[model samples]
Target: MTVQYKFPDNFWWGSAASATQMEGAAHEGGKGENIWDHWYKREPNRFFDGVGPETTSDFYYRYKEDIQRMKEIGHNSFRFSISWARLIPGGEGEVNQEAVNFYNDVINELLKYDIEPFVNLYHFDMPKEQQDKGGFENRDVVALFAEYAKQCFDLFGDRVKMWFTFNEPIVPVEGGYLYDFHYPNIVDAQKAFQVAYHTMLASALAISHFRKLDIKGQIGIILNLTPSYPRSQHPADLKAAHRADLFFNRSFLDPAVLGEFPTELIELLKEYEHLPAYKEEDLTVIKENTVDILGVNYYQPRRVKAKDHVPNPDSPFMPDWFFDNYEMPGRKMNPYRGWEIYEKGIYDIMINLKNNYGNIPSFISENGMGVQDEHRFLKDGRIEDDYRINFIKGHLTWLHKAIEEGCHTKGYHLWTFMDNWSWMNAYKNRYGFYSVNLETQERTAKKSAYWFKEVAENNGF
Candidate 1:
């Protein structure tokens, strides 16, 4: 017998994209260059296929048509981020009316189609000017971010009720600060902890600001939660998993929802003398302000084991010091993206929210496969993305199970609505229901797009 899956009432059936990922016109409308534009210009070879985000899906110019397509896909809601540099060229001084007008137009267009708009303030694309001034590392950037959030609320809050402070806050710390993959790549674990702290502080400040605005809809932060698993029953493996969880998941999860940093986090950071700089009252603010909802983007779970190699005395201390990634033999995998396939990660996150944290309303804000060389699958005008169809269905099955078992999952939004410029990977991996033709500016819905429309209409698959 075939199994069936269904969603809750008023399930938001849409996808997510960032300003840097989807909106072209990077230099147009008095928009200052972001870190992405600067990074590509400095090192074009760093991005896959040498494709930058500047010439993305052209959503800046083609939003009306794109939004119309969203309606056809039965999207009751959509989530997209606003570029800070575009809105305020220098990141904190003058307001660029052109950007304000453009975003207002986009939000209005979505509403016209009866699709609710979920607007995110930041998505890893820090303004180059702000980065030069120390970005998230310096405490000053947090103040600027709060100001930017306030400006956004003052302008667009009336139309957009759901506000997100940041998308995948841990990503920048991991990918940018610790790993060499992202810009301003520094491998200092201390700096990574500081950056993570400032980001959470910024989120708390924004939530406090939202309370002042008295917005109608919910405000929250988006976390890419990775459930950590121990490799064995050994005490060392169990301890390693605990440390990994403290570093990756609890760093943001605790403060954003529980309104306080985990005590384990403090002890771990103290062991390394990596405590971030904080004032006397910062803890109070964090303990007081928590999000109204939780936006979880679960891609995969972390399989951790006790470190194989003892710590090299001369080597720089990193998060890997305590644990190593234990690749499970014969585990399901998504070869295209080179990531583990764990559909139950979604349910695990839900259960974590229900059991440990208060069952705050949450949603799968971003989850999808990123296929490299996807054009090879294109036939005629459509890309037959059966793999993507399977990916969504598999994950949705787990999500449905979680919800039926009383997880307060509100909705599921795919990683993207259409193929756009991904950071580092650029356009190499396409995670879209619609195919984007760069040469002719054509948009064609993949088979998954049609399949998703039915799922959205019926609230099931």
Candidate 2:
């Protein structure tokens, strides 16, 4: 049976991209080098196909045309990030007037076309200067981050109403410290704990500063929420699911929404003697300030079960110590991105928000698939991305169902608006509705873009 989805009134329909992934003027406008710039210089092959972030989709020079394409696609709102290093060279010393002017121009242009701009402060592009001084491992980085947030508010708050402090805060903890994907690859769980703590403190501090400024816009945090699915009804499976939730979702969810750390997480850290050092007043600050809104990015669910093998004492301690991923047979998958596609996971996330998170007003900040080698879909002047269209429609059906049942979801933003550079994946995966020709700087709307425009115009599918 096919279900029809009609979105709510004035629901935002758009897409999102980060500065580092889209804007390529890395050395222009007095921009300071980010960790990506430094790391790619050291190890070019670390990224896919030796593609660094020096020149992405060229949003820096092509935003004018890009904004026009967004209007053509019926995007009333677009969520993008401002580069901290671009705005302030050397992380915290001086503000770059050129960068400020550039961002102001982008924001004003978006507003001119009636497209609301959602600006995020950080999007995995830590300043190289900050990374050289220990990145998020050092507590001082939190204050430096807060200073950067303050500068952003002073420059763009008047036009930018939606502000996200950080995007997927736990990603750095897992990808950089506990895993070997990102830079400063350390396999220490204790350092991962410290980095996660510093990120939370930075988010809370940004919230506090936003309140002090009395900005007219709303401030929020963007969390990548993965609903954990237990393999069975057994208590062991449930326990494993709990640990996964605590580590990935609640680690950031609790502090940003409830203003307190999760008790189970704290107990686990204490048992391992891996708790991060915290000042006495830090908890008070977190508890006092909570976000005005929340951005939930749901790509997939975590299918977890009780670990069959016991933890080895020789291995470094981490979250995987208690749970193991359970791959169920006959489950639908997005083979293009190699990620599972569970449509109902969107409903589960919304229901959790309504029941446990005080029914806070939220939105689908990012939800889309990344297709490797998408050029196969290219057709006569446009890419026929019917699969991508179907992917979005399936999720929107569930999202609409949740809203009908009283979930406070305001809008839906896809993974991206155009093909841009990713960190490790580089430009390998294409999740955009528009195709960017690297050599020609030409923008062509895909078939999915036309379909999304109709959905946005009618508020339904």
Candidate 3:
């Protein structure tokens, strides 16, 4: 007996990609250097196997074929970001006509195949010049981002109905400020707070601008929401989990969706004197420009417990200072990525949105497992990615339940369309339905791709 798990009518089905991760031609076509190019030049070894983004899947020249593949695979929609450096060269001045033509062609190609284009303006690829000017740390950069977003709207808004201001905006804060994983690496809590604040403000400013343009589309921001679970029902553990949620998830969620910062988060920041310098007018702008839609990117959940030991009072502040990660025994894991496989986290997130966030329109923007050395799984002419298929099915099972309970969840998109270079980790883990051979720049659809095509055509398995 074949089990049928049909989704709602008109549900979106596709995958997501970012410009820097997929589009090569880093220097050609008048594309200025982004932070990825700058960082790779300085520290190539930091990237996986000495591979950088200079010539990533060569999607810059192969998008036509890629879109044809997408159509064949039954993709009804696709999400991708625009590189600020590629579009504006320096990130704030004259637009590059070549870049404009490239994006316009890509959008038209997707539309020609009856695929809806979901465009995100920023995806952590800051232009080198913008980073030199303090990136999102400087207040001036917020307005500059708004201008860039307005330009995108003016140029492609007619065809691109869905616009996202930022994708996983909190990532840069965690990667650059609190950790040494990203560019301009600075391990400072205060700076991290400021960066996060400004990014949220920039998103609101973009949303405000989008509304004023009278474009027939929905504008939102994509957030990587990891539900925080306590180690036990103990009060201390629960409190620790709550605080972690506020810091990592609610800090951006409340402002983007609810149009205000959580009072608890604000109070804690104020107590530490780590709040970003902001005017009353900025708060008003954020409050008045909440997103019309939301894009939830879920991969894993956070399991936490109360701090095992008191931190040194003199140590610099950090979110983990309040709580410690608790590795639950017997928890499922994605060994390649070292992330827990908790499909229920997706359902919990949907229910949370429904119960608390007014069940706003949204979709799964990015959810796919990355496997290290995936070439080992290749069979015959295709990669036999059964694990990847199971991964998607498990998550989809939970997502289906959420929708059954009236969760207003609109779609589910995988993390990527093809294997491409990732920042820092750069090609370390493959997370795509189509495996790309770097040497030949050839894209071969994995076994999961065939499975997914049927799932999309049938609306489910």
Among all candidates shown, the one with the greatest lDDT? 3
The TM-score of candidate 1 is 0.98
lDDT of 3 by residue, 383-455 (tens): 9999999999999999999999999999999988999888888888999999999989999999989999999
lDDT of 3: 0.94
Q: Which stretches of candidate 3 lie over 4 Å from their true place?
A: 1-3
Candidate 2, poorest ten consecutive residues by summed lDDT: 1-10
Model 2 lDDT tens row, 21-85 = 99999999899999889889999988999999999999998899899889999999999998989
Question: Candidate 3: which pairs clash?
Answer: none
| Candidate 2 wrong stretches, greater than 4 Å | 1-3
lDDT of 1 at 389: 93
Ranking by lDDT: 3, 2, 1
Highest TM-score: which candidate? Answer: 3
lDDT of each: 0.90, 0.91, 0.94
User: Each candidate: how many clashes?
Assistant: 0, 0, 0
